[model samples]
Every structure is written in structure tokens, then in C-alpha cells.
Target: MDKVIFSFLGTTLDAGYSAGRWERWRPTIALCQQEDMIVNRLVLFHGGGHDSLLKLVIEDIHRISPETVVEPVRLQIRDPWNFVDVYSALHDFVRRYPFNTEDFEYLVHITTGTHVAQICLFLLIEARYFPAKIVQTSPPRNSKRVDKSEVAIIDLDLSQYNQLASRFDEERKEDVSFLKFGIATQNSRFNATIAEIEQVALRSSTPILLTGPTGTGKSFLARRIYELKRAKHQFHGEFIDVNCATLRGDGAMSALFGHVKGSFTGALQARGGYLKAAEDGLLFLDEIGELGLDEQAMLLKAIEEKRFFPVGSDKEVSSQFQLIAGTHRDLSQDVKDGRFREDLFARINTWLYSLPGLKDRREDIEPNLDFELERIADQLGKKVRFNSDAKKSYLQYAMAGTTEWAGNFRDLSGSLLRMATLANSGRIDEDNVSVEIQRLKARHQTINSDLGVDESGNSHQDWLELRDRIDPFDQVQLAYVIKVCKQSANLSDAGRNLFQQSRKDKKMSNDADRLRKYLSKFELSFSQVKEW
Candidate 1:
């Protein structure tokens, strides 16, 4: 069966009764001739006063085609200029209308309504309150005769447009690249994470928590998200980024919630603060874990109420700002430790993302290296290039088992900066590569010197890395054995000292044998730790 065509009747002089009678110069009548397919029903919405004109319209529609049923819906709307009344009436009509898409298709006539009514109809259909296609009616250009001959059906769904879809895809890609600062990253996990962040940023204004080690770009990512939202017309105010760790004592409160003049000794002038500055925009609080308990309480209120009072002020100011928090500390652990507010953590924990450290995403190192080189060229106003040998040598040492990127991307960035600065004549050769490698090794070795490890330098320096290589029980016991060996003179002496307390329980008391076997569990010996 064909679907019903729903439309609003505009009671203008042309559509109204003229000369004390009906006129065949109606748009609905002319609408019938332009149709290629049969219309099951024509539902017209009109005011109670337009009953006579509606009867004429129905008669004309029937005269054109007896197959089409005309249904006139009586609504009590006195003023079409009152958008609320007209929209509410139409909304109620649509809600009460029996919509069965399986049995009948639907079409909404965008024409033949007041301008306000037309806008309401468009909004309702776009919101899916009316699941129907749009049909527009046009009268004859001469204005003397009615003509629905110029009619058009517009499809709202844009997926049908191939070129438009391609354009949208390209826009999304550019947004992702902007977030990465045009790094052209290669890590699959990292790429997927960026895409997810973009979607959340575009659609929501909830508090987002970015947790990662220092120098993982949490602050940078938050700023990019703000820019993306601003570009999409989601926000308009300035992006207020605060390093919460730097806020101290009364300064924290004064900086975040503002302060009235003369609130404190140094209060020279009244300030609007970060929240007000970020009104209808984004508030990025980096190192959120460092915020004091009082600050956290005030921040929670600002987020929940969108209103807060500044220091020494009774008047409440409003700021409906979006929040993004960055942290290196485990907030849940802080909550348990009584250092962070539990409620604040719970509120902002809805959208949490843990950015991976550089060591964890070694696959992206090559591309990042190239990105840094370009960044250096941009910064110095002169391009620099690494000789083939230098590039290959740096990559080898960077990816070696000995390398521990404890500081993650920040460390890599600094290393590149140093190498670029020391490059002779804008070119990094083998000499430059050799110097950087030695410096990195010296730094890493100095940091790890205190950790008990192989004196022969044959094993990985970090004992934490061996946690996966052995059983939990063996790992603990092996660490203790290594510690004892470091303090003792020789293997027998270290073994004897370790078993001094528990040796009485043994049947055959061969202390060295027992210690040897225990050490062997971790593939270690007294010589390794003692020599170190």
C-alpha cells in the first residue's frame, strides 16, 4: 500500500476561501498531478476556523483522484507566530499519529505552512520524531495559477552521497592528525585510541581523565581535544589549561575560583579565574592528583552546579565549562590513601584513557624520529639530516635490549634535541651518533647503579623486568639472596649468613648447596651480585 502524505495548511489569502466560495487554485490539488505514484492518504493540519476551506480542499483533491483519501485534522492553534504553541500542537499530533512504516510509507510536506511551523516540522523530522522523507511544493512562477508541478523529495540521510561521505572521512582523518600533531603514527593501538578520543570529544562534554606517566603528552592531547571541539562548533570560549601541581595554598583557590579585590593581602584586583575564563569552553587541569582537598571540593561543586563563588565573594558566578583532567598518580589509590577525594575521582572516571609509554609502543619510534627531525628543522630555521650510518646506529641502540626508556616520549624528544643541537653543519654523522649513545648509556647506568644486578653486565639491569621470567616465590627469594650476596664476602659466607636463622630446620644442612639451588631458580649465582 502507498503511504500517507502529511502536511500543514497555510491559511493565506490564496489558500483561503475567496469571493464567498472555494477556488480550485489550491496547492494540495495541484500536488496530485505531479505525483508519479499513488498517494494513499493526504493528512492536512488546519485551525478550527479553516473548516470551510478544508472541505473545499478535500473536494478538489477527491475530484482530481478518487483513489486518494483526504483526512483533515482539527487543531486549536490561534497564532501561527507563537512558535511554542504551533510546535507543541504539531508535536502532539505526530506523537498521537499511528506510525506503522511496514504498512505505509510516510512523507512530510515542507511547504504550505507558516515559516515557524516549517522550521518546527524540519526539526521534528530531523530528530526522527517523524520518520518520513521531505516533500516541497512550489506554486507557478506567474502567481496566477496553482502549480505543484515543481515538487522535490529530499533525502535527509547523507550516506547516499558518495562524494560527501568521502569528504567526511577525510575530515575525520585530518582531525586525528591534528591530535597527533601530524606525526603519522604507525601503532595500531595508538591509532584506535586517538579515534575513540575524537569521537568522545565531538559528542560529549563530560569530564575526561587522561592517566599516564610524565611526558606521555596528556596535556597536549587535552589541548588538541579542545581545539577539535572548537573547530566542530561545539565550544566557543577560550581553552583554560591549569597545571594543578603549581597551584599552592591560597593561590590555588584564588587562581581557580578567582578572588575579590582585597580578599587577600596581595589581591590587587578582582579576577574572574580559570573557570570563568573557560565559560562554555574546555578546562584542562594537568596533574589533577596534586589538587588540595579543599580545591577538589570546590572543583566538584563547579562541575556539578556550573556555578561557584569566588574567594571573599557571596555572589555566585556561572561557568558551564567542559573538564579534562590529566594525572600520573593512581587516583583510586590516592582515594584509598585519603589524599584524593573519592567523589571527585568517581565523577571524572567515566571516560578514562591510559596513554602507553614510549617503551610500550616501540613500533612508533621510527616515525616519531622523523617527526622530531622535521620539528627541529622548523624550530631552527635550517633543515638538518642524519647520515645513513648515524640513523642506523641510533635505531640499533634505541631498540636494543639494554635500552630502558624510563621517561618515555619526553626522554626520546630530549635525546633528539641534544643530537640535533650537536649536529655538525646540519648533518648528524657517526661521530654524533657515537657521542649520544655513550651519554645515554652513562645516564641509564648511573640511574641503575644502586639496583642489585649482574656485575658482568651480561643481563638486563632492571630487576623489575625479570618479574615475568620466574615464579613469584622465586623472584622474591632471589632478590633477597642477591641483596645478601652484595653485603657478604664470598659465596660460602653469603650462603651461611642467609641460612643462619633457618638452618636448624634442615635435615642435611648443606648451606651452600641449598643457596646454590635457590639462586639457580632465577638463573643467578653469588658471583653475579657479589662482584657488583
Candidate 2:
């Protein structure tokens, strides 16, 4: 295979007005003269008015190596120092030049060009505008002869460097851990999801939607994503956080897209809102589903086009920012119910990541317990540790299915804070954990006693009084049966659903009587349950 090198013609270095030019080694001539690194063809690029120098260098290269081919090409660049002109000329030449990797190996000679020319060539080579390795030549230690020149070839492909590749892998893992709040989370699925979220947050500026129940770390993860991107220099502006639930009517509009003076009855002063403040940064609208339809429409316009008219202002304002939305409510359901704008929902739903609640992630509780203690130490300036027995006892109760973890991470953090605050000196003993467990059990029972509504976050006030009197275990079943009764037309309809599978074995399925007997256990009648 023929070995080819592309290089710029250094007019002064390759020129010889007299015999004295032979004293200094010329890079182009030396590249061809190196016995260890043979060059079959040289494509020498030079600007106009360098024909004499170009000819002299080519002749010198051929004098020492008779078999070497000298291919002199004129770039016609008025200024070799002008990057734009030099790059454009070289780019066109590269496009037109025949590249056959199977028949030839190529190298970009960086030793002889002007600084600007060298930079252009490096940029083009790194971007793979042409396929080649970079070859650099330097002056020999004690020689000025072309035959003694030093040559170094560097391959740009990173996969070839094992140590550097391993370093990058380690950095990527550290970034993933950052997004997870440095938690040693054990769930495989959750870890994989965090990895995906990390990648998406870094590589894209699109709107990211994080969905989960309350206290599942939607807001925390959103802020972490912002922090990660900011640390990587992806964002330059501030982190704008807004809870949509706090926004209402004119106030919501004013808070999001600025408001001019006299915008409303209480428009005391002009305001620059979150969207503008988040320019070149990230805006986390926690509980984004709580946004009113009008605000949603304006937000859609602002997010889609980066321009919007603020409240009571005819002039349009512009801002460019990244949007990350967090919602505990099901946005798809909000769109169906006409509570949220469908267009806005679709726009922000491009990268949706759902976080699992604490109850669903039992394995992570232990690690989070340690993390909470670490946080407590940081906040209170007092270090605390759980004894082995206390830690084991707490983990057992926390991992059990009976533990609701209603507020998820917040609830866990609060529980740990209480235990740590009450710990004897710096040690949490077994007795402390038992008291905490009983307190958590009582808290969960209180939460269950009011579990009268279905999954849609509705409330049934009538069932609350009856629910308060029921045992924690019985509250769930009674609440579900009451839900069916409320949805049913009458006693028989409710009875059939309540005894669905059991009625199949009856010779004469008196479902009403069976349901009546069941309702008596709760001291409730169908008519009363239904009416409520």
C-alpha cells in the first residue's frame, strides 16, 4: 500500500535563495527522507506566489528519495493566515481528492503549516472530513539534516486508548450517581432509568417530564439534572423553580411570563417572570399539571417558539431556556378531563421519566436511611450512627408491606430525623428504633383510616367517619366495597360485583343476601352507602 501525507508548504522553511537553505531541516523534505516512515506520495498545499518554494521543496524531496511522488497543489488562498479561506480551500480539495483506504494509508502532516493553517487542518481531521491519522515532525536533537528528523504519528480514535477510555467510563458512572443524589440505590430497574435520565439530560435541550407520586423525588431529580447539566457547562443562567399549584389566575400568568405595570387590579410594579429569569438555564415547574388552561397555552407558545407576550403587554418578549416539568398527577388523565391543554402536554411529554415511590423500592430503604443520617449530620453539625441491632430492626419494619410510606422519601427522611434527634448521644439504640416503628405504624394506620377514595385523588367525606372506626386491615376492603356500592345503581348490582367469583359455586346464588350479610359486618346498608 502507498503511504501518503498531506502538508502545507512553509514558504520560508522550504525556500533556498542560496546554498545556506540546506543547513536547516525542512519538514516536507524530512518527512519523505525518514527511513523508518516511508512516504510514497506527498500532497503539498501552498498559497499563490510560493511556486518557487514549492518547486524547490519537491525537488529536494525527490533528490533523496527517487521513488517518492511529489503532488504540488495550489490552494489560491490570498491569506494563509485566514482560517475561513484556508479551511474552505482545503475542504474542497479534500472532497475532490480520491480517498482509497484499501489501496493507501493517509497522514495529515501538521509540522510545516502556519498556526492558523495547522488549526484548520486539525479541526477538519478531528471532524473526519477526511480519514487519516495525524503525523507531527520536529527538529532532531543534534542534527539539521532531513534524514535525522523526529516523527510521531497519533491516531485520533479514542477507543484505541484503554486508560483514557476507562477514565471516561468512570466519569460517566460518577455522573449517573450524581443524578441519583449519590444514593447507593440497589434496584436494577431504577438504576437503569436514572442512567437513561442522565444521558438524556446531558445530550438534549428538549423538555423533560418527570412523573411520580408526591415525595418520589421528582423535584429533587429535576434539580439534580439541572445541576449536572450546569456543572458540565450546558446551562449558564439560574435554576428557576415554580410550583404550578401555587399559581392561580392572573398571578400564575404574571409569575410565568412577566407582567407589565397596570396589568391587573393589583399590578403595582412590572415583573420579569420565571421564563425570562431562566434564560440560558432550566425551569422546573413542579406539579405542572396544576397549571390553568390559559397558562398552559401561553407556556406552550413560549416553549415552542421562545417568544411570548407577557400579561397586559402588547410587546412580545423572548427567552431561551431548558424546560423540565415534574408532576404527581397523571397528565394524560388531565388532558382527557380538559383540565390541562393537550397541545402543551404533548410538547413537554417528549422525554417522560416516572420515578417509583419508596414503598415500591424496599431494597433502597437501607441506603436512604444512611443518606438521611449523613444529611442530618451536615445540617445539625452532629454525627450520629445507628447500632447494628437498631439498623436491622428499622430495616425490617421499613421493608415490610404493611409500611405505607405515603409521602415516600419525605416521610422516610422525617422518620430518620426523629430517630436521630432522639438517639442517645451519637448512637441510635434498639429501643429508639422500636419506638420509631410504633410511631410509623400509628401514622400509617391514621393514613389508611382515611383511604376512602379511589386512585384518582378524590375524597369521600362520609366514609371518613365510618373509616375511623374500622381496623387498619379492614379499612382497605370496606373502602373498596363502599366504592363499588357508590358506583352501582342499587343493592343487587352492587351484590353481584361484591360476590363475583363466589356466586359461581352457589346452587341458587342469593347475592343480595350474601352482600347484605357482608355489609352487616361493617354495620352498613347498601342504600346508605350508595347515597353517601
**Model 2: how large is the Cα RMSD against the reference?**
6.5
lDDT of 2 by residue, 198-280 (tens): 88998999999999889998888888988999899999998999999999877889999999998899889999999999999
The positional error of residue 520 in candidate 2, measured at the CA in angstroms, is 12
Tens digits of per-residue lDDT for model 1 on 15-112? Answer: 65554333345556666656575777999888778777777778767877788898888776879879998889989988988899898988898778
Residue 53 displacement (Å), model 2 = 4.8
CA lDDT of every candidate: 0.83, 0.86
Model 2 alpha-carbon drift over 4 Å, by segment: 11-19, 45-98, 112-120, 312-316, 336-343, 453-532
In model 1, where do residues sit more than 4 Å from their true spots?
19-26, 47-56, 74-92, 140-148, 449-532
Leading candidate by TM-score: 1
Query: What TM-score fits each model?
Result: 0.81, 0.79
How many residue pairs clash (N, CA or C atoms closer than 3 angstroms) in each of the candidate models, in the order given?
0, 0
